[model samples]
Target: MSLFTNSNVTCPNCEAVVNMPAVGSVNADRRPDFRDAILDDSFQVTTCPNCHEAFRLAPLFNYLDVGHGQWLAGLPASRVVDWPEVEDDIDSVFQASFGANVPAAARDVADLLTVRVCFGWPAIREKIYLKGVGLDDVTVEMMKMDLMRRLKDAPFVQGTELRVGAVDDQAFQMVWIDAETEDVRQRFSAQRALYDAITAKPEAWAALRDKLSDGPFVDMQKLFLGQGRVAAE
Candidate 1:
């Protein structure tokens, strides 16, 4: 049951033979090794020796529900109680969702993936460090619905998802939020243009762009929520 003890599993990047060390037998606490977290001070990191690929490992394996049907164990963000870089268990959501190339595209701005907004930097720092709202997952219409949902008891935004962008987390942050003004929408759309240019499939790009252009610069949150599930959010 050890995470690092996969007797038959080899390093995906280096093809080096490896084995997962079993943590404990049945009915054990099943806690992960905190060595990496101590080193990370509570964050996780992974690097591929063969490719120099680096990524946060917490989000990737944190979603795994492999222990005794205890789905609740992995629910809250607080469950990430350790920090360790296991190249064997590197975050693969990006690779599986948007393909492996996204790591290169995102490496430059990884720390700034999500930023907390505030009147000042210190306030922003405190809210993010303690409160932990996802900086990269913020969206216009999504923000509106979320605000109205908690503050006003309002309904969710219902519309076609227009343009989507990877502001941070690998989740889709919609653009239909009410607070998004024209300028914000335009900037969001402009970012989409970058993805279109990088795609290997030019035809898909044209088709996507044409479909995206159909409306008069509409909110993309409605158009792209589920469709761009594969796009790095």
Candidate 2:
């Protein structure tokens, strides 16, 4: 079930206090509109009644979409630096709910779900968008790595991310966005063949796949971040 709680929020524009309903967990299978809101980049947007300014809350919720076989923990981008600890925490939560610690029936459900952790809106939105388009996300991350090598002025930096904005038969529309402000700094498209070529040669990317999939936060950015959690042998 989807859960929301009314909380006090300070309007960043005017410093006015506003009471709003903040989401705790979203069950996209039951309320697909929530999923649409996320994809359209409108979820958790609130207008300050005092200053009439629009602001979006940082995502800090669990998202479940059984139909799409996804389960994600959407966290604030500021927490990216602490991803290793956060990953372990979310993993334990998943285990308690649907993994080995749970009943056999729940564990069966877990087998069909792809568990992930995403920082900020763009990261989570890109994940859902990729799933909708039937794209392999791990491959897409590998493609980004290749793009960084080819693009002379790629803006691959801290607090900036390369995310999939849209896709078509021929190409993938990509954007470089500020993780905190959700501002798009640049946009470009990569040939669909880039994704296909990588998918065709999985053995070549086997080591990379292992690193990206080592935790629920299966993003290539982790490679650039501080030393990530070491996987159990």
Candidate 3:
């Protein structure tokens, strides 16, 4: 049985209505979670290319999302899938379904989380500012604690201490630290929102500098200056 026989997809960015169908391979209901919903849909996945909003399975709204999930940035969004036309031609990774059979390189790609939004120059600049924090050994643990606390309310917040590298290093590496876990989507989403909020109002953000409490705002500066006590102090 299918979960969504007639579902609609709207661009989180353009708000454009997307017309697509969820064609499942196996059973959509038996698949467990929304993320798994698409995997079951051997033939269809809904996405908003304009904003990069993707619902691997139809009834994407049914996906286990906390709030303002991964696609909030709202641009350059799409979930590309590999479908096998021939029975024997199937890719082992997609066949495995649980990502257990993924090779080393592809496995690494799985750990990554992406966000896309068009905030224009100001938003972009704010993100750039946060990225300025250096991931030196001294503040690494603090960064971990900070990520943990901030994400405390966010269940399934990837339990790993994120590796936050320098700006140039961000492309292929996150330098801070690594605390891995299965739950992180929610925390990651929150971080992105916080980033957007701070970026939109830098002066107001600066005034609340003391409130960051390990959000990595002033902490980034501390990481840069080698000050270990607190980000504000």
Best model number under lDDT: 2
Q: In model 3, which range of ten residues has the least summed lDDT?
A: 74-83
lDDT of 1 by residue, 24-95 (tens): 121113443332231222333345455554432222122111222211111112221121111112234323
Q: CA lDDT of each candidate? A: 0.29, 0.91, 0.32
Q: Write the per-residue lDDT of candidate 3 for residues 130-179, one digit (tens) a residue.
A: 33342222223234444556544433222222433223422322322212
Residue 158 CA error for candidate 3 (Å)? 15
Segments of candidate 1 deviating more than 4 angstroms: 5-44, 50-53, 57-233
- What lDDT, from 0 to 1, does candidate 1 have? 0.29
Root-mean-square deviation of every model:
19.6, 1.4, 18.5
Which regions of candidate 3 are displaced past 4 Å? Answer: 22-45, 49-233
Of the candidates numbered 1 and 2, which has the greater TM-score value? 2
**TM-score: model 1 vs. ground truth:** 0.20
The better-scoring model by lDDT among 1 and 2 is 2
Could you estimate the TM-score for every candidate?
Answer: 0.20, 0.96, 0.20
